[model samples]
Target: MNSHLLNGHYQILKLLNDREDGKTYLVEDVNFPDSQFIVKQLRPPSSNPQTLTILRRLFASKAATLEKLGQKNDKIQKLIAYFEENEEFYIVQEFISGNPLTDEIIQGQPLSEDQVITLLLEILEILVIVHSYGVIHRDIKPANIIRRESDKKLALVNVGTFNEAITNTVDNLEYMPIEQVNGNLKYNSDIYALGMVAIAALKGLPAKEISNLRSQKNQLTGEIVWDNKNLKVNRKLAKIINRMVRFDYRKRYQYATEVLNDLKKLINVEDDQQKQHHKKLLLVLTGVVGCIILGVGAWQLRSPKPGSDAELKLYQEGVNKYDAGNYEGAVEDFNQAIKLDPQNALAYNKRGDAYYRLGDYEQAQADSSQALLLNPQDANAYFDRGFAFSQLGKYKEAIADYNQAIKLNSKNGYAYYGRGLALAQLKDNKGAIRDFSKAIALKPRYTEAYLQRGIVRRRLKLRQAAIQDFDTVIKIDPSDAKAYYQRGLTQSINKQKYVALKDYTEAININPKYIEAYLNRGDLYSDLGDNVEATENYNTILKIDPKFIPAYIHRAIHRFSFGNYQGAIEDYTTALKLDPNNITAYNNRGNAYLELGNKKAANQDYSQAIAINPNNALAYYNRGVIRSKQKNKQGAIADFQKAAKLFQQQGEQDSYQDAQKEIAILQHNLAPAPTTRPKSNNY
Candidate 1:
């Protein structure tokens, strides 16, 4: 069909989309040439008069609601008019000069956590007003949300309530909550739709695809496996979004206002955290000082005081400097305080902390030991000493000191956290997890503990639990790029390729200098058979970190797979330059050389590999083949014998047999060939 005028006033400029239910078009108003608008033509299910009457009533009601809604909110698209043309309904809405949310979304890729939050906040702000008017945006998907180019603000378009009158309206099924299908549409149903939209945009996948990615299914809990796809979402924001999209509408936010209120709280919390960071540091110093005083023994009141006024003043200054991140200055102040009052344990402990911050584990340990000597039961000194030991790679000593600290103060979260790190270093994952759990119980917002525990969980192959842990870290600190990157690793291992890719992308988006994220993303792209995209990612990695050996090796492998022998050789050579002792690199480079018919070069690489690892049967076999081709029968036989012995020792029976056959062929060739040629001529 051709583009035509709608209602003899709006001329269809082009068809925007053609769906089962209707056709959406960009149009110009003939009455006002400067005005551009969207015209949607919908056909009722049937030509029956009764159906037409019901459709007309529903359309008229929705149009009127839109016009009023648009009048109240600039973010909502304005309804200009609606009319019946022939037997179809034509609705005109103000055109928005922007791209749909889906336009920037690449399937299996994700937007940054902050970007997604910003999008949700803008959409929810508008939804709060729409829901207050008892309107449910029956359709909430990426395509329905326009991100305006002018102000970069998101606009909610195509507002229509799908109640009993339009219950059968075809819509994006992926975004539809269960309640909508059950005809139990509530205001929260819109919240569910919005949550799905966020998920779709974050995963760079459509709602339908996201819906299928759900691995957790229960009456009260419906969570997609891709929910933690490496986006460092704030914990509160993640929880809020999860609740918003609950399968049971009753579990979701009952009103858009409810979600808006929570988002407002998140915004305020984030703003306060950003704006009052210095204030928080001062508060921390004050709190730590108060704790130290309260925890001191009655010996402090004895004559010839443990600390003089001058010492106390210097100690306080040291603490202030420490809080301000001036570790060297803090250390100097602590030294002066200690000189003035040798018995001041707090001064020694604070100095130890400054030393630790400066990466001087030796001085930190000495200061902490002196603090412990002055105050035998000081938990802070034990904890500080434990931290120093842990940093020095003395896991056993760290564990011992952490135990002492915990014994002195059972509620010390840092002690437990420190013990957990020590245990992790010792490969005691269970012990580490217990300590981490204790730390988390004492401090609910312990991001480091959560991150470490997540890493341990991943190591233990408790992948789902690991994901939950990373999710918590993200919630506590949305800007934790490492959390997102780690979560992506788990997702990749879980075989969620696209979801893993999205997570890696989110990590890179948060931290542009994240080389590992780029490498993982490139690998995922290669596995997905998009070599071009994969090469681009590898190129990006090289651009960011040219000295990265793995990038060169991986790109070389990629080049080799596609018959690019020269490129593969170049990459392999670069990788070898970065890591000269890499056995795999030498072997791979040899193979690439062999492919290019550089037998002498191939022989040198194979010899180098064998020299590095004499048990490398494959390398010996390769060298034997090259020697045989060069007519060096004796050298070929020696190499084959070595290859056979090594392969047999390594339990590679087939390889061992191949090497034996090659040896036998060489031996046969070395024996009475003249007699065999005479017998063949006689025959």
Candidate 2:
């Protein structure tokens, strides 16, 4: 193509790529020489008149929708102008300049998991806008994503037009089944392609190669497996992708809006893990690497070349011993190496690694610090130091070392993952997720990443998405009892009691000694009104761990429900013994005493509970009842009024109303004495 003007204003510059529907070209505007654009020349499909018209209508409808949607999100490339020239339709859009995610992966210099997640979130936000306008991108792959050179953020391009144009041909349509061949035409199809892109980024493989791994008969299963293994980024992310790419359209996400919501949740989870991992990596890099560098420098400056070589040799031997799990031998060899070559960084690093294995974090940190001083650029030294720092709970220093390690080697997924763990310890969820995502991008089969990300997601209140992540964990490691337990907890919170029970049972079956599972299952049983089952579960937990206070409390509540006041009191007392500040136990015990007609005991218990937690309106009401029974009408009225005020403050109208009723009764009984009382006093 010539560099001359085309369509009056667009001057052809260079061809970018050719697609089934059109040729994409980089062009400059004749009127504005500095402006650049991507001009797509659409070739109308040669088909019957009826089919051609339908395709044209679809294209026009999609184009119009895109124009409306483009105004909402800045992440999408905007279409500028469209016109018909020589019977061929052409559309001009903003030209985005940057490398594709595919290119980055192929160059073996892919972005961190955090970066990938950030980009995906940006795209997802754009999808939300596009889908809201009843338009699907229909194709979303790495090639369609561009990283802006100026901001380093991602943008979506080459969307909404080409798929319809290419698939509109009558002859091609007759041979290709819409459901089988045109599966990529729907919104979820785009999501499927995006998942493939994510998998490719994680595994450093092409998307088509992963697709080929799926058996024709069990395509969805293969996708799930590959996505789970490669993106071990998080369980929640994998599940979201799995849902989006479901073979059954009905089972897939019905709208891009749903996918967007899921993407936000996944982003949050991954971000938290990323931050924690970054911190741990920092600590290791600084402490371990610093020590190794210092030790190495000291060894190199030692007198006698022979002695230095011998020391180096001894250090290497020590490292080998450490690698072989002979920690004692390794320590002996490292000491000899240090004696001969006092500044051997490698020797220090090896010794530190050994100490770490031996659960001597302090010694490990000391050795790692010496190593880092000897070789500032040593990534391994930094990593070891950070690990020691994290083990010692020196999280801030650990994070700093991880940052240095990442600066030296961006592909260090372990460092990022470690940092995420550290950040999580500090309750920096957002930062942790970011580091976790980076780790996932670097090493997709990182099962720990998924587990951590799922936990963070749950913390962020993304319950449904968190459940999806737990499901991924289960798929990756079927024997993961913790995953099952966590998923059960989330399901229970979401009110899926049956599903929660099943997950809890699975967890208990896998690890029969899981006390938490038994306790949670007991709570679930109680929620379902299965008192017998609930009591049995509580008893089971008590058998395993008798000191479990929550179990005692639950059992007490169950006893009280069954009118076993004495048993309830006994259980409540035991619970209080286990945990002295158990206000619930005090309150429940007071109820039991009241039922037993021990007004004084009931009053004392209620007063104690109220003293412990002044905001306990129920305790006040109960105490008021006791006072009324004891004929302290004024005291009872005061307590009832306070209870009503407290209930009203808590937004409990029903409880407030009940308190008011009691207050009214007390007021009627304490009504002013008639004037005859004065006459009696005078007499």
Model number with the top TM-score = 1
lDDT for each of the candidates? 0.78, 0.72
Could you say which candidate leads in lDDT? 1
List, residue by residue over 53-99, the lDDT tens digit for candidate 2. 77667667666766755564556888887776765677888888787
> Candidate 1 residues 374-478, lDDT tens each?
556567778889989998999999999999989978998889999999999999999999999999999999888999999999999999999999998866555
Q: TM-scores of all models?
A: 0.52, 0.44
Global fold similarity of model 1 (TM-score): 0.52
The 10-residue segment with the lowest total lDDT in model 1: 674-683
**Candidate 1 regions with alpha-carbon error over 4 angstroms:** 1-314, 475-477, 609-683
